[model samples]
Target chain A: MEISYRDMITVLHGMGFGVLFMLAFSGAIGVIYATTVVGPQWPRSQWDNAMFRFYLISMAALAWLATISGAYIIYPWYRAVPPAGTTDLSAYPRALLLSSPRTAGWHDIGMEWKEHIAWFTPIAMTMVAYVFIKYGPRLALHRQMRNAVLGFTAVAFFSTAVAGLFGAFLNKYAPVRGGPDIVLMQEK
Target chain B: MSAEHQPIGLPTGPGAAAILAAGIGSLALGVFSFAGDAVPAINRAFIFWQPSGALSGVTITAIVIWLVSWFGLSRRWAGRDVALGTVNVAAFVMLVVALLLTFPPFMDLLQEI
Candidate 1:
C-alpha cells in the first residue's frame, strides 16, 4: 500500500533499468551471433540491421540509466552520514550494514564490487553497440573482431549478472530507505 | 561472398579501437577502484561527488580515459588495418584482469601482498 520514494527509485534502478538491460543482452547477443556467425542462414536486410541497431541502442541506454541513477541518486541516500550520537541507522544503508559484523560483508563485498563492477556494463555495452553499428554486415568477415565483440558482450552480461545478484542480496540485507512514502493503494 | 564480404579492403581499425578502448576503460575502473580502497589519500581524492563517495570519481575517470583513448586510437588508426591478433589478445587480457581486479576477494588477496 505504501512505498517510499527512495525505495521506488531503487526498484526502478535495479529492476526497471538494470534487469531490463540484463534481459536485453540475450536478444542482442542472439541477433549479433545470428547475424555474424550464421550469416548465410539469414537475410541481412537493411530493416533487420536497423532493428538490431535500435535494440542495441535501447539496451545501452538502459545500462546508462541504471548505472547513472544507481550511482547519483540512490547511492547518496544509501551512504548518507548519520549525525552524531545517532542510534537508529535505518536511514543510512551503508552504515546499517557496516554496524553489524554479521552483515558487514554485504557492504564490504557486495556494494564495493557492485558499485565499481556495474560500471563495466554500460561502458562495454556502449562500445559493443558502436562496434556493431559501425561494422554491421561486414563484421562477419573479421572473425577475430567477431570473437572479440562476442567476448565483450559476454563479459558485459557477466558484469550485469554479478551486479544484479549482489544488488538483490544487498537490498535484502540493508535496503536504501528514505524519502516521502508514496501511497500505492489504500488498505481496505 | 561478394566484394563487400571480402576482409582485405575493409577497415577494421575503428572497430578495433573501440574494442581496445573498452578494455582500457574496464581496466581503469579496476585500477582506480583498487587504489581507492588501498590508499586513504587516493580514496579521498576520488570523491568527486560527496554523495557517491569515491565511486563517482572512479567511474568518471575511467569513462574519460575510455573516450580519450578511443578518440586517439581511432584518429591514429583511421582506415589502416592494424594487427588485430595482437590487439585482440591485449584487449582480452586487460579486460579479464580488470574484471578480476574489481572482485573483493581478488582485491583482498592482492592487498595482502
Candidate 2:
C-alpha cells in the first residue's frame, strides 16, 4: 500500500523515538557498568562478561539506526524553503526548518552542535565493539577498552539529549498533521 | 584480599585516570576545533567537505590520537605507571591548552589584542 509523506514522517518519527529510547536505556546500563564494574576490584563473573557484550552490541546497533533516521528528519531543514506557487506549505512542519524565523533561537546553536556530535556516535560505538571482540578474555585489557566504551556512550547520550530537546521544540511550535493527509503525502 | 580475590581488571589508579583524561581531552579538543569561533582556518581549509564535515574530520582525528595513545601507552607500561607517566601528563596538558585556547573569553581576548 502507498504511504503519504505525513505517514512516512510519522513512521520515521516513531522509529526515531524507539531508537532514542533504546539508546537511553542502554546508555544508563553502560554508565553503571563503567562506574561500578570496569575496574580491578569489581566482581568478574561470566554473567558480567555476557552483559557487557550484550550492552555494547545493542548500543552500537541502536545508535547507528538512530543516526540514519535522525538524518532523514533533520537534513531537510538545512535547505527548507516555503512551498512554491499554489503548492500547499501547510502540510509541512515549519518548525523543522532552520530557515523558519518562528523556530530560530539559541537552540539552533545547540542543534548544530548536536548534529556534529551525533556523527561520532556510530563510529565510536563500532570501535568499542571492535576493541572488545578483538581483545576479549584479557581482563586487564578489557578494562581499558571499557574506559573507551564509556567515553563513546557518554557522547551518544549527550547527542540524544540534544536531539530530544530539538524535537520537543518542534512539537511545541509546529505540530505535523495526523491521519489521511499523512498517508496521501507519503504515497506522492 | 588474596590474589584470587583481587580483581583482574584495570586498577583504580593512574592508569584508569589516564584513560579517562585522554578520552575527555580528545572530546574537548573536538568541540573546540569545530564549535569554537577561534578556528576559522579549519572551516575554510577543507574544500572537499562541508564545514560540518570538516568539523567531523577534526573530531575524528582527535579521537584517533586518543585511541592510539591509550592503546600504545597502556600496552608498553603497566596500567598505574602509564597513568602516572609522561604520556598521561602530556595528554592532560594538551587538553588544558585546547580548553584555554577555545574558551570564548580567551578567543575574544586574542581577537582584541
Candidate 3:
C-alpha cells in the first residue's frame, strides 16, 4: 500500500509528542529536585556537589542529543529535499512538501548534508560542555552560560515536540487528494 | 536496625549483579551499534561472522564489566554508589535508543514513509 505524507505525519506526531511529553515531565522533575531536594538540603554538601555535577553533565548530554537528533530529523527534508509539490510556503517547506506525494523520496541524504549537520552537533555540545566546565557555577560571572544550558534544554525539547507534531501532520497529508481522496480510496 | 545491616553502596546479591550486568551490556551494545554503523568491516564481522558480533558484542561486554566492577570496584566506589546506578541506567537507555535509532525503529519509520 502506498503511504501518503499524512500517514507519515501521524507517526511523527505521535512519537514526537509522546517523547516530548516525557522529556518535559522529566525536566520538570529535575527542576523540582534541584530546587527543593538538592537545592535546599544538599547544595553545599560534597555529595550534593557531586550529584549536581552529574546532573549537569547528564543535562549537557541530553542537550547535545536532542539538538543533533532534532537536526537529523528535519535537516534532510529542509535543506536537501526540494519542495514536494506544495505551494503553501512557510518556515519549513519540506515538511509542507509532505502534502505532495511527489516529494516522498526526494530527500537527499548525501554526505555533505550529513556532515554539515552532524558536525554542528558535536561543536554545539562541546561549547555547552566547555561553558559548564569553565564556569558551571560562579553565577555572579557565568549566569549567562548556566542559563544557556537550561535554555537550550527547554527550547530544544519544546521545539522538537512541536516540530515533531508538525512532522506527524505532514506525514498525514496525501499527495493525490489530500485527506479526502485517501478516505475515498480506502472505501473503494 | 544496626548500622551493619543497612545496604551498602555496592550492589549485592543477585539483584545488583543482574542490573550491573544489564547496564554494562547495554553500554557495550551501544558502543558496538555506533561502531557497526560507522565501520563496514567491524559491522560485517559482528553481523555476519562468528557469534554475530552485532548481536553478542554488547552482552559480552556488559557481563565482563559487571563481573569486574561487582567483584573489584563495587566496594571501592561505595561512597559514589549512586553514580554506578546512574551509569547503568544511562547505559541501558543508550543501548536501547542507539539500537532502535540505528537499525529498525527510526530507520523503518523513515522507510515506511
Candidate 4:
C-alpha cells in the first residue's frame, strides 16, 4: 500500500481541517457558554443531596466499566485494522488516503495515531458522564429530550451494527486491490 | 470524598447538547471534507454501513438502562435525595455511544482494500 506524496499531503490537509472544525464548533461553543451562559445560569442543581449522590456513585461504576471495556476491546481492534504501511484514508467510506513511496516514513506516524486515538474514548466518555452529573438534566422539556435521546440512540446503534456486518463480509471476501505489487490480504 | 464522589454519570442539557452537537458536526465535517477526495473502493463498499456499526446496539442498551434508572431513582429525584435520575440517564447514554464507536466500523474501512 504505497501512497504517493500528493496523497499524503491531501490526508494531512484533511486531518488539519478536521481539527480546525472541532475547534470552531465545540471549542468556540464551549468558550461562549463558559463566559456568558454557563456563568449566568450558575449552579441551579447541586449534588450535595443524597439521591444525587447515590446516582453519581452508580454512574461512576457504570462509567468505569464502559471505559475499561472500551479500551480493552476497541483499542486493539482499531490498531489491528490498518496494519502499518497503508494510507491514512478517511474512516468514513470512499475517501482513500493516498501515500507515496517517498512518504513511507510517515506510515509509522499514521499507525501510531490509529493505535492511540481509540484510547481517548474512555476519557471522553468519563468526562461526558461527569458533566451530566454536575448539571443534572439540562432538558427542561422532558418529553422532547427523552424522545430525542431515544431516536438518536436507536439510529446510532442500528447503523453501527450494519456497518460491522458489512466490514466482516468485506474482510472475509471482497477486499479491494491497489497497485500491482501490493496484493490485498485479509487479517484475522 | 469516596469513590462515589467522582463516578461517571449522565449529561444534562448542556452535556447532551455538547455531545449531540459534536457528533453532528463531526459527521458533517467528515462528509464535507471527503466529498472532494477520491472515495476508496473499499470505503465505498462499507461507508454506508459504518454508522450501523457505530450506533445501534449501544443505543438500545442506553435506552433500557435509562428507563430502569429512571424508575429506581424516582424516589430520589422527588427532592428526597439529590438529583440522580437525569445523571443516571446521561451516564447510560454516554456509555452506549462510547461503546458503539469502538465497533470495527471506525477503524476497519481502510483495511478492506
TM-score of each: 0.95, 0.54, 0.30, 0.27
**Model 4 lDDT tens row, B1-113:** 33222223332334444334334332322332222122455234433324333222323333344434444444333323222344445544644444333333433443354
lDDT of 2 by residue, B94-113 (tens): 54455444334454667677
- What lDDT tens digits, residue by residue, belong to model 3 across residues A63-179? 445444434443333433335674554434444454456654332222112212222222223333333343323321222223444433343344334434444444344221222
* Model 3 CA deviation exceeding 4 Å by range: A1-44, A66-130, A140-153, A174-188, B1-113
Q: For all the predictions, what are the DockQ values?
A: 0.67, 0.14, 0.02, 0.04
Best-to-worst order by DockQ is 1, 2, 4, 3
Assign candidate 1 its CAPRI class. Answer: medium
Q: Going through the candidates in order, what is the number of backbone clashes in each? A: 0, 9, 15, 33
In terms of DockQ, the best-performing candidate is 1
Per-model lDDT = 0.87, 0.49, 0.39, 0.34
What is the lDDT ranking, best to worst?
Answer: 1, 2, 3, 4
Q: Which regions of candidate 4 are displaced past 4 Å?
A: A1-141, A174-188, B1-13, B36-113
Best of the candidates, lDDT: 1
lDDT of 4 by residue, A2-67 (tens): 553323333232233222222233332232233233442322445323343344344334333433
Candidate 2 regions exceeding 4 Å error are A1-48, A68-73, A80-102, A119-156, A171-188, B1-25, B28-41, B50-81, B84-113
Error of 1 at A90 (Å): 1.1
Higher-ranked by DockQ: 1 or 3: 1
Model 2 chain A: lowest-lDDT 10 consecutive positions: A179-188
Q: Give one digit per residue, the lDDT tens place, for model 1 in A1-188.
A: 99999999999999999989988888988877886757633336888888888888999999999999999998888889999899999888889999999999998899889988899888888988898888787677777787888889899899899889999998998888878999999988
